[model samples]
Target chain A: MTDTITISVDAMGGDNAPRAVIHGASLALRERKNTRFIFHGRQEQIAPLLDEFPELRPASTVRHCETVIAMDEKPSQALRKGKGTSSMWMAIQAVKDGEADVAISGGNTGALMAMATFCLRPMKGISRPGIAAIWPTLRSDIIVLDMGATIGADAKQLVDYAILGSALARCLFDDDAPTVGLLNVGTEEVKGLDYIKEAGRVLTEASGSGFTYHGFVEGDDIGKGTVDVVVTEGFVGNIALKTAEGTARQVGSYLRSALKSNLMSRIGALFATSALNALRRKMDPRTVNGGVFMGLNGIVIKSHGGTDEIGYKSALSLSYEMARSRLIDKIGDTMQRFPIKVASEAPEAEPEANSA
Target chain B: MTDTITISVDAMGGDNAPRAVIHGASLALRERKNTRFIFHGRQEQIAPLLDEFPELRPASTVRHCETVIAMDEKPSQALRKGKGTSSMWMAIQAVKDGEADVAISGGNTGALMAMATFCLRPMKGISRPGIAAIWPTLRSDIIVLDMGATIGADAKQLVDYAILGSALARCLFDDDAPTVGLLNVGTEEVKGLDYIKEAGRVLTEASGSGFTYHGFVEGDDIGKGTVDVVVTEGFVGNIALKTAEGTARQVGSYLRSALKSNLMSRIGALFATSALNALRRKMDPRTVNGGVFMGLNGIVIKSHGGTDEIGYKSALSLSYEMARSRLIDKIGDTMQRFPIKVASEAPEAEPEANSA
Candidate 1:
């Protein structure tokens, strides 16, 4: 018998929790047959939901957790108060203890990150963990990382992100070596911050080691799929991700209004139902719900807190794919090939003062 | 007789300059009866293009320039080589010399800003000039500032951007007290850098003095048009702008492919031509081509370097409206009413070190 991948689910996390979490697990199980789940939350609440899906009962085991981290709780507070007893902490603990292959949560991002870092700790040679999002591009899906995990990063950290993001693309795309790019305002050599520029130099040197560095790419290049992996500091990466999401929703609104403006368009929309459905599927955010936390010892995926069952299922699917690929090992191997130097040892090759 | 708005044109700037510049000026003259242009470029290039538009010849005069700034020229190189002789510099000087009400360019962003700041100088009580882009939103259009004019900004600079952006909204939207917001990673009080947080405090105190402060707004709020002016540091703002553009293009590409996958959808696309055209018009980058350079002594509008005649015409139209509105005086008055304190005078109320 094939060894089943165990997934730890934070049942009390997110807005539509317990039900969404259980239902999502059921849906994921339908697609990924060789899987087992341990739901961490109030066992009584999870039991009733699991009863609704009788088939999922055999594959899932409910673990009682008394505390629920608030959706808006501070990261420091979450870490201090809900260290081991909270549902989120317990789910992450499962992965840390090697009881589960990966953990999935749709909780407050800051708290989730803080707790995950505390439980799993950073991988060797990795100072901090970053979140990598799989973005749907024109050519195909691309991986973009450091999506608001931490704000500004030094050149060494950015280089680490390149390795982390490349590892993610390797797993998702099933390619051993993925083309990587540093996201900047312009593709010109003189553009962006010093750290980005320095990281570019480092990535260039590490091209043949595992990943292929495509040099600097602009914001537009991300959607154009100019590279398989796009690396950026968390602040710009977060803004870019949110801006793209907002723009997609904005365009969808425009399309809806345009199709409903007149009878001719209404009839046209009816005829183009298949086409519009395809378009909707391409634009659907739920299909890419999970953001994998990289540079950590264990795997953790963060789903959108407000997502429903369908979105949660997508996140679980991501978790399963990552576990199957042994993404952590791939990242670890990649890091070993190109060991990152600490910031203290870095040469003071600072860029010009007016560069910014 | 009404005082004609004399516009300075960088006729040799963009990819399709001289012709586009002349044609756009003619288009502007059609809409605004009281406007004249002093086209700065090689006279030989301008004279022939001017002959193509006979009506424009009567209202336009070509100023011979020995140098033209290359579209890809570095700011430092342009400043050193082109100096006062380049078409871009001459146009900006026209505004400085009060020979033209405003200057418009379809040239390099860095070169334009470098020259404009050098020629026009920063406005009174302002540390740096920020580029303000008018973004189309679900509600209507909102102004986002510091779109790569400079990189990271201090609290005082951010507050200046708010005032500058507010003054712009007042001119364009005709609202005396436009609502303003500081762009951040999250809307929470503790999120983002201390500069943004401190700016929030300052703006809160200055509310109703000139503009209505809406506090912090996240990236999604930009598309939702949650406020009239969205203020941010250039680095994040530029990334947001470009990311939004890329996403729009990506979605458009997806729509085209989806609509052409089969015959039924092709027929549907044909039937929905008018509706699609409306949507296209709304999403057209040309319609919002102008990026107004604010916190400067004189007005300068930057058109997209790769834009067409229609787009150039839009930039010219913006220059006309801004000239007519006496935008510079309004900004001056706003600045005088709310003089920002220098950083030296700021209280030592720094945020915690771990905030970033």
Candidate 2:
């Protein structure tokens, strides 16, 4: 039998709170052969929900605490006041004490990032943390980094991001030497601001050594699966992620409206159930919702903002796989093996034929 | 009878270049009666294409201008050295000498923006120019501004962009009072940086004055048609525009690939043609190809980057509508009549609520 993979879940986070989180956790435990979940919130609030599931038994399954960081809370504030928050404290404490193999939350992203940085701290030889999200393009899936961790970043940071993203791909997707692509306005070597141009050179020169660095990719290629990993600054990444979600929602809504316009549309939809379902399965965000926070000491995946039960369950299951993969150590070791040389810190270093 | 609208098109621009541009122009002229097109390229080179059509019997038709700007040419250099280039000379001379009503080119965007800004300066009170694009959102088509021009803008500049975008809506879409929304991270009172926050305050305080200025809106709302005009800094605007294009392309490609997965998919597609076609029509970028360069003295529109004849034709039709609507003069007079009092430019001059 497999070892009991106990996990601490933030039951108070997400739009659907305890009910959704608890329901997902219990579902996860039931689905897996051997697993346990610690639901963190308040006793009075979470007790009834835990009791609702008789499969979980009397009440030893959930470990209640106090406080919750609302979705709208500023990230930094949540990190500072994390001690009082039951979800934050329980998650971090479980990991710290080795009681839980992983901690999962669909809380405010800013707060989660801040908490991860302050509590777990970065692995050795890492500066900034990045969010690794799976974008289902046409060819294959691409892991995009720094979705919203840091607002502004330099060229050196972006190069490092590429390295980190590549390393995470090795552990996650099992692509030992994954192809990395830099997200940019254009594909030219000299395109983008000085920051991006310099970063491209770094990625190009350092390619094949550790990471299989591709040249550049546009926003449309995010779902096309052109590359395994795409690296960009947090600001651009955040904008891209939000724009994709928004646009998809807009198109999906529009398509639904068009198809449900009248009796004719209803008739048309009847013949195309299989095709529509195929499209639905492919476009469903839950199919690729879990986004790993790279360069962190532990595995923490963010559930999509409007995540329902299926999406929440996907995040939890993804976290469990990540822990099984020994994700943290693999990324850390890969990074330690080939640390990036930053321009800001590597002053007076040998400049090998600057492409610029 | 409507006045004959004359247009100068850059034949040596875009991926398809002279061929696509020529076909697009011909289609526009053939389709519409009161529209005349002036092709700006080498006479000898265009002569063969003209011979094929044999419709250009009038000697005053095609303007003989040589030289072409490569897509990769540096923006500054292209703007400076391209004085004699076919596209540049045609656009400048056409607008400057009133030879053509407006100049349209799908050339290098940076160079186009520079030419448009330097040649056709903003109407009287306009400090900076903004590019307005029509987004096919859920509710209806909304005008998004500062899409490519004005990189890092202040609060008042964004407000100015909103006003310009609003005016474009009024002139083109015939919406008298377009609701303006500031593109932001969140909708909270203090969300985003100082520029966005201050812009929100101005937009909120200046409600019911000329255009209906709505509060801040998230990026996702772009597709919902929540607001008629969406304004943001050029960086964000450019990213948003690119993201949308990229996503639509990705979805289209993915559907094609999924439909070709196997015999089942192909067979499924056969039955799903009606539903799939309905989807294609809604997401097709061709239906909405023309993007207006707002806050300029004349009606200038930019076509798609990888656009073919269909997209180019759409741009031509849009240009015709702009000419028919007399958008430039109306917007120019509107701006002059109600000068938006920017806090920085006119801090001391506070016009009473009545004057607006």
Candidate 3:
């Protein structure tokens, strides 16, 4: 018998609410027959949506939750007001209570993170929790972490991110020893911040700790698939992710305009429609919808709040993969194997420098 | 009579060296008939390259400088060894001595910035110099500054960048009140670091000083052309620029593969050749090769070290425009008009938070 993987979902969270949530689960269930869903939200809204997918209705259980966290609610305020009864909180609580293998939410990222951390608590020895983004590259998908979960990570925290990110790569990529790289301005050893340099030193020393340290990688390397895992503080990671997305959209717009500019090109686009579809599928943000929250006791996937059913399904699939691979255990094991020792003295502060 | 714009060139700096420099100057001269060049490098190599374009020989004078700063050389080490005699140094020296209106180098970025600061010095109140790149956007070009000239800018420095970037935009875009935005993780007033928040508050009060403040903008807004100027510290700005470049290249690669995937697609590509060519031209990095050094005493341009003659020519043309527009004087005027007052007390530190 196939092992059941129960997913706790905050159904009333996203822009599309219970519709996308229930529809997404039905789509996921079609592919993964062993999955069951615990929907946490208003029973009235969720029950109607579940009826639309009779197959999903048989495998789903709706838990009543009166409070819904607003998309724009401050993390602190959301935690204060909706700590126990909110749908977002109940979804995460199901995972903590062992009722669900993992939790998925298409809600406020900050609120989801705050609730997840407050409920699940950070894994032993993990100081900061980070969100790992699965970035598409020329070779394959690479894991980039701390995508604006928090700002200003120290050297120790960066090293922690390295381990967390590597564990994520292992689960997603099915690699035992994934390669990790510290994101920097340049590939040179002497480039970037003090914390980055210190992280490099520690990662080098802890080379065989379930991941290979690929040294420093620049922003371009992220798209180039230079390493399996790329680690950085939240501030830089968030900007890099958004900047790439923007550039892709910008180029996509240019391509659309170019194809429509002339009669010949329009016919050409018709001829190349299938090929263009393949390209579109490759570049589509929906395929990479989930941002996995790492360094926590349980797995939580944050889907894009504005994404539709198709995008939410992608996030669900990722959650299934993570749960089946025992992602949290892997992270915990790596954390224990490679305990980061604080340096007695700070690394020498080098004068600020520029790179080409 | 057209005023002649003299450009100082680091002839033996780039990967192509003297040949690309001389050829580029000739190309620029063809367009802007009233232009002269001071080529600094090994005369023997430069003279032969200059002889290839006999028209350029009359408009150019070669200054023999034996030393050439290696692209990978440390900024401080390069300064210590090649201070006076390096081709890179002599190029900026010409600008300071008023022998040239602007200096253009495809040398080490760090070395160029160091020498430019040492030789020309910063403008009266500018603490840190920034490198501004002209980013191509949906609504034309927007200026993004501090592309890794230095890391970690204070609120005052960010304000200075706003003033400097606004001046460049005014000169290039020909709009007196160009809009400026602070680059952050989120556009919300409460998002990002204390320093960024402080800058936003100051910019709000100082709106219309020279440029109209548009509040905070995210990384995606850069490509959307949400504002005329996107001000960020060097570390984040540099990463964002490279990430965009990488994404564009990645998309271009994907497009090429898609068009060549099948026989019908290949035929379609042939039919839409001109439209495809136009798209290629728009996405070409050569069209935007120069990085303008702002907040400096004189105008300086950094060309991509790996770019060929076509790219080099683009940099030369940008130099001509800056000189004609009197970029330095415009910056000086804006800086004097709005002197940034330091905040009496540090802004309230907000708890670390996450953003979608």
Give the proportion of true interface contacts each model preserves, from 0 to 1: 0.63, 0.32, 0.71
- Candidate 3 per-residue lDDT, tens place, A1-356, comes to 13889999999888998898889899999999999999999999988887788999878999999999999887777887788999999999999998999999999888888889888888766776889999999888999988988666789789989989999988888898899999888825233388899888999999888999999888998889999999998999999999999999999999999999999999899888889999999999998999999988899999999999999899999999999999988988888788466542322211111000
Q: What's each prediction's TM-score?
A: 0.95, 0.88, 0.95
| iRMSD in angstroms, per model | 1.9, 3.9, 1.9
Q: Write the per-residue lDDT of candidate 1 for residues B1-356, one digit (tens) a residue.
A: 13899999999889998788788788878988789999999998889887888888778878999899998887777877777899999999999998999999999888888889888888877787899999999998999998988766889989989989999999999999999999888835243377888898889988886799998888888888999999998988988999999999999888888889889998888888899999999999998889999988899999998888899999999998888888888898888888446472332212111111
iRMSD of prediction 2: 3.9
TM-score of chain A of each: 0.94, 0.88, 0.94
Model 3: clashing residue pairs?
Answer: none
The alpha-carbon deviation from the true structure for residue B206 of candidate 3, after best TM-score superposition, in angstroms, is: 0.4
Q: Candidate 2's residue-wise lDDT over B215-318, tens digit each?
A: 88877778678899998877677777788877777766655766676666666556556766878877888878877877766767787757888788888888
In candidate 3, stretches whose alpha carbon ends up further than 4 angstroms from where it belongs are A187-192, A343-356, B187-192, B343-356
* Chain B structural similarity (TM-score) per candidate: 0.94, 0.89, 0.94
* Ten-residue stretch with the least lDDT total in model 2 chain B: B347-356
Off by over 4 Å in 1: A187-192, A339-356, B187-192, B339-356
Clashing pairs in 2: A136-A223, A137-A223, A137-A224, A137-A225, A138-A223, A138-A224, A139-A224, A140-A225, A220-B246, B138-B223
